[model samples]
Target: MSMFILVSGPFTDGRVWNEVVGRLRESGAEAHPVTLSSRPEADLETHIEDVVRLVDSLESPGELVLVGHDYAIHPVLGAADRRPERVGRIVHLDAGMPQDGDAALALVPDPSVHELLRAEGGPGPVPSPGPAQWQRWGSTEGLSVRQLELLSRLAAPQPPRTLTQPLRLAGTAASVPSSGILCTAGGMTVELVEALVRTGPPQFRKLADPRVGFFELATGHWPMVSCPDELAEVLLRAAAGEGRRLTVPEGESPFLGSFLFDTPERPRVRNGRLDLHMPKPDPGGAQGPRPAVLFVHGGPVPPHHEPAPRDSPLYLGYARYAASLGVVGAVVEHRLHGIADYAQSADDVAEAVELLRADPRVDARRIALWVFSGAGLLTADWIAAPPPWLRCLALSYPILAPLPGWGAVGSRFRPVDALRAGGGTLPPLVLTRAGLETPRIAATVEEFTAAAEETKALLEIIDVPHGCHGFEIHEPTDESREAVTRAVRTVLAHLEQPS
Candidate 1:
């Protein structure tokens, strides 16, 4: 019989694994459930310690199988590095694997995700959850009524610093076997899973090592809740070294196709300066000028082209998607961070809109802005004092206001207080946060809604509790991605309507 340690996501306590652990036990295996601290509170190192403590207390001399679902990948990987000899194998079940110095949750690829992490004061060591905090998250839908009650009685708040603690696994390799059990049913797209395996950074790249394997289950993000039997079977297979290669199905790539632009440049003056980018459609052409969408990249320091091909998610994926739908999409590069005020980024957006409006190929009537974290705030400022042609705004975890706590700006340039200082009227807005319940994120949205008022909708992807800011771009579960796509579509439709 093998000893199995199953870890759950950030908001969840060990109780999430009750059914799975029971199945493992019934099948003659010993299983332990590991819990992580909730967000905006716990950091990364504390998380690592929690897992280490659990493994050490087991007292089992034989190799242990470690399983991490979602956010638990950080701690599990860290623990394996610490006790490679005792651990037999590691499994990342739909979880993002972290690289050296990269926060675990930061592995999510969305720019809004990066911004959200940044807004939360940059990843650092987080605390383990104590009983009360675990109980709160237990009541979430995935757990059964009895399970919730049990967790409520047994749960605890994790420490606050576990999130930011860096897990040192650079030279240390996992001596035990590893596997990634990806969920395909619940918003987990084949595209994302394959991308994570193929192109994900160093931390995630570790999963592809020869000693590691892969498995795919047609389950949602919470497989233990939605399909315990299937999850159990997959786990058993991996434990027995019977897992197989998991491959994403081939198709006309939904996100990688290219579209041709008219090559005409839209140029306009705003705030006493001319701004320029690719132009939209003109009415006189065979088709009316198409509605326009502008994607603003994050960071004040990195030039738009500096992060070009990698940053091309904007140009290649999103902008192309919009263009395919008859929407004029343009990627805007804001001025470098230190040289210009962050507010100037917003001005640049306004200028881009003006340029789009002036272009003979552009339909100035319908314009939309999609901005991620750093750019999201800048876009918000521009919307606060919206230009005449700007029609709709879709902000993915936009930092409408400055974060309230310490250590929020990790490696990124901090925004000026003036960017979100005074109360100002904002345009129709769609606001999202990673962990909606976190005090800081929730408060930020509340403040944003108060400013934007009536013409706003707030969507918090519950499954993606922590890295909401930019996680969407990292290709979150299909449900989350659909929700975002829907939000963008709805906003675009609204912008196209008579105002």
Candidate 2:
């Protein structure tokens, strides 16, 4: 027999867990749903104390399971840190594993709410989201009309400080065994986490711990309200340390599985951080230095991710393909490792460009930079002032603007804004857009296209109507192959033009 302490996240009180609590108790286990303070003055510390008090009051002799949902995870972790001995297992129910100094506001998906929390000394209680806007927090699948109504009605305004205040952990709770309950409809799954871990990020490798278990709820983020019985059953199983253990596969990442072309390997000359694939000398000998195309791979890849992007098959294939075009092909390792590291990444790319220009085998006057994915932001500076040597700038399924949770990275990363600024003559810009792009990224692409038109920039669009993001590797259709070939030849044509 084990005792469960259920804690709810923002926009709700302990009552949110009533149905789940009842089901857990009916299974012959002790269960309690804690209601955090509703006062406007209540903060994270106050909420942590509320959970601590309940833990102290519990007289059950069974194992103690601390179940935290969404924002409540902060307080639950804090309480567990103070009383590690009392916490038998910590169950993350559709909640994030926030580290010390992480604020709940950062985990929130709604931009309006994010702005509200950033406003210091603003309003009292944070207003609850309406039913129509509930999707901003998490998917509402599996929820009935009555359940949605009850959820909206019972939703309470959370204290603003509860979100704004940074979480302070003593590191004691980490030793406690843990289990994760992923909500697939809310856009996370055990398989996805496994894939990410296989990508070789050291941070995610911690999930492969033998002591940590994993489970999935097909319902949305609010599983307690939408599927209480199922949530209760998972909780009972979690208390017994019974769930799937995540594994990091020994195979290469899926993103590196395939490439558009099946060209033969070329001789690669590696510098400190750059790999240059030298093309075969012109059959008719005695030609001028060959033009080069430098490929910039996308990411917010973990800085320490093993087998850096430059070494990946996707990038190596592109380099070899470029060499086959009778021009130098280059791949550089940039530091775009995290959301906040774009500035450093820009610097790294700039250094790589200088290295390329100084190479004796390359024609510095005829160069093209082809960027992909999140690295699209790095084009802002070049867009603002098109250099004489830059013959073309190409982007594929790029992020033209920052996403919501990126905070204010300033105009440095906003390529659309740079386009609208209207500076020097823009380079021939080539853009390949995926038809089934993520909504936020699609918005940025649309915005960039509009800006390109407004500024009358020399722009060209390649439409991958049947493709999704990362189509070059994942979607190996005739369309994908043609797009890759067209984009490459187009860039080569620009490079071949007489200076």
The C-alpha RMSD in Å for every predicted model, in order, reads 11.9, 6.7
What overall lDDT goes with each candidate model?
A: 0.57, 0.83
lDDT of 2 by residue, 291-331 (tens): 99999988767654666788776788889999998999999
Give the alpha carbon lDDT tens digit for every residue of 1-48 in model 1. 788999887556888788898888889889898766555565676677
Candidate 1 least-lDDT 10 residues: 250-259
The alpha-carbon deviation from the true structure for residue 186 of candidate 1, after best TM-score superposition, in angstroms, is 6.6
Best by TM-score: 2
> Model 1, residue 237: displacement in angstroms?
1.8
Candidate 1 — number of clashing residue pairs? 65
Judged by lDDT, which candidate is best?
A: 2
* Candidate 2 lDDT score at position 375: 88
lDDT of 1 at 17: 85
Error of 1 at 387 (Å): 1.8
